[model samples]
Target: MPTSHCAYDTRLLVITLILLRGARAYTWSFKEAPSQCGQSTVAVAGNDGTPPFHILIAPFGPSPLPNGIETRQILDIPFTGNQSEVQFQLTYPTGSQFIAVVSDASGFASGGTGVATMVTNSTDNSCFDATSTVQFDFVFNIFPTVAQVVQCQNLRISTPNFLGIIPGGQSFVIPEGTITTDASTGTGFSYQANLRAGTTFLLMGGDVRGNGTGGSVTYIVALGNNDGSCLSNNSPSSTPGSPAGATSSSSSPSSTSGSSAGGSVPTET
Candidate 1:
């Protein structure tokens, strides 16, 4: 009887271990079939002289329809030292909204840090109207060294720009009057810019100084026009950039006058 009872207890222990491991694993799913979704290969520069790293993205939200069902999705973007550039694409159901949790997968595990930046442009003239606005929401897991956003005429060429600092959890917006914070949190905030038709902007967040402990950040980018109707087709392409305090030798983009404060353009890594 003693031998039989011991065997039963051992089996129960194994089953409990398996269940605990499965709980930590996260899966990705969507309410409707995604029209476009795929991964790309790219190179990510390391922070403080480390090797290239990878980013893990987990997207979750409800369908745009009234009383829509909620869903989730996951993607892992790998960056190597040999590759120069790559493209990633995802198209959500029309009118639907989602938020993505982005993290430095490899860097966080290895105790390294890096920059996270997403570059997006609107070339479709029809998508904009008199009320169009570009919105950005950033949720910081830990306060990063620096977080800001910039609007440019063209990302490839230097031009006049608009820069705004993202004050995590602050009641006020930076650079005084360029934009306004729509929402505030103890560790995050949201803001919007009334940009003209056909605009290119960069959303930047992450600890480039290797000062932050391993923590994930949430990012949401949306375009709304026609009186608050969400635009679903304008997904931005993300690419890592250089560390703080590094100057680019390239010529500065020409000055273009804007109502917001002006600053030198940041060099992309």
Candidate 2:
């Protein structure tokens, strides 16, 4: 009886240790903007073992306007993590409609890696009447030691029209040696380009089909060396590029309008 009890105690101790290890390995925190239309800044520690951060954004409340012309919310999420992959899993309530507006005419700068996965419910009511009026601009300043390679991948977009806002748009300036691949099976888009040190890449476009909600979109932008190792890694070879910043542009789309929520927008040259 004594031997059996000793063995049971040992097993219990092992299990407790495992649980504690898991708790330490993964740690996350929650934050919200003062209002739905405000900007939110998420700061992540570099080389931390924490999993991808999750952001829960509430849906827009009932609009006071009878026509619902100004019934929209603007959210600008700027991530600041050095030598770390800035990743976020965003969740929105049903009937929530929003668009990725171009806040800066120039574009946001990247610290070599930026990734976001957004999940929301679909709604017929969009912020815009037509896709032509909607535009998205993503400009990244890539600073690398060697010939750095930047790859942008559109893993999944729920609405086919949203693909127009991706890199393949007309305003996009593809640098030399850039290889663009259109997915043969689905409505996916991807591009790989080699950028010299201290050069900027511009990706801007408008979709003819209006942007609606109800599904999800997964987009990934990563910078790495020729050997294919992510520059976001915390190794000696990992060249920590400059941090990316997103600023609001003066030009606003006439189709959609909203007031800023007073969140500080990070700015990088």
Residue pairs with backbone overlap in model 1: 29-72, 158-253
lDDT of 1 by residue, 85-178 (tens): 3245443323232222212342232211112111112222232122322222222321111222222111221111122112111011111223
Lowest lDDT sum, 10 consecutive residues, model 1, at 13-22
Single out the weakest 10-residue window by summed lDDT for candidate 2. Answer: 13-22
Reference-based lDDT, residue 112, model 2: 19
- Cα TM-score of candidate 2: 0.21
Badly placed stretches (over 4 Å) of model 2 are 1-101, 104-190, 193-206, 210-216, 219-269
Off by over 4 Å in 1: 1-49, 65-67, 80-86, 89-91, 94-106, 109-269
List per-prediction Cα lDDT, in the order shown: 0.24, 0.24
lDDT of 2: 0.24
lDDT of 2 at 212: 22
lDDT by residue (tens digit), candidate 2, 1-269: 01112222322221010111112222222122111222223333334343323222212222223343332322334334322223333323222323321211122211112111121222322333322221123212222211222443222211122211221111122322323333432232333332222222222221332222221121223443333332232211112342111111111112221221111111122
